[model samples]
Every structure is written in C-alpha cells, then in structure tokens.
Target: MTTDPRTLIWSKSSYSGNGGSCVEWAPAQTTTGIVPVRDSKNPDGPVLSVPTRSFAEFIAGVKSGAFFAA
Candidate 1:
C-alpha cells in the first residue's frame, strides 16, 4: 500500500528545542522502508523521501555530533 506524504503523521525530534529550524519526518512511513521528511518551517515545501536505513544513519550521525560546527 502506498501512503501520501501529506497525509502521513509527521514528527519532530524532542531535542529540536524551540528553534524554528527543524525537520519533520513521517515515522509511520518507515514501515515501507522509506521516510518522508519536510521542513517544519515550510510544511508546504517539497518532501524528501529517504531510505529507512539511510535515514537511521543520518540520525545516528546527528546524535554523534558528526554535523556539529567546527
């Protein structure tokens, strides 16, 4: 079954804080091996569908501070 990205329930990280810069992802869509992501500041913007494994790796990188400013 295919689900519409717009109709999927999206979520933001709890660690996102109150910052306006945050991305939302549809966790429910992960069951299909793909996750739909969109900018919280621009809900109507384009959606990026990433593979579940790739998305998990990205999350791991974030948690490990791999993207932290030098």
Candidate 2:
C-alpha cells in the first residue's frame, strides 16, 4: 500500500529529543491497523508501513531497552 507520506498526518516522539535522528509516524493511519513510518529528516523519502501489533511490540522493545547496544 504505497502512499504519499505528505498526505498523512505525522508525529514525532516526545523522546526524539534535540538530536537530528528522529522518525515520524502517521498515527491517524492506525484506523486501518497499519502505521506508516518515515524519517523525520527525510519526509520525501521512503515510508515503511507495519502492522499495528508489530508496531506496538517494537515500542515495547524500545521501552524495555531491547534495542540498546550493550
């Protein structure tokens, strides 16, 4: 399901901080149970869409520091 990222509403995480490395996601698209994600620095770049359950799991991993480098 290819879509123009510009057409969807995007939101950056409050934890994104001042660092330039950040991602934006279209929460509004969750109505379809799929979330579209893209780099905040590159709005015109490619978008990655994932299932809502997968997105939730990813967020849980982030919160649990599962992605942090040991």
**lDDT for each residue of candidate 2 in 1-70, tens digit (9 for 90 to 100):** 5656788989997667676678899999988889998888888888899999999999999999889745
User: What's model 1's TM-score?
Assistant: 0.84
Off by over 4 Å in 1: none
Clashing pairs in 2: none
Candidate 2 wrongly placed segments (more than 4 Å)? none
- How many Å off is the CA of 2 in candidate 2? 4.8
- What TM-score does candidate 2 reach? 0.86
User: For model 2, what is the alpha-carbon lDDT of residue 4?
Assistant: 67
> How far does residue 16 in candidate 2 sit from its true spot (Å)?
1.4
lDDT of 1 at 31: 86
RMSD of 2: 1.6
Q: Compute the lDDT of residue 35 as modeled in candidate 2.
A: 94
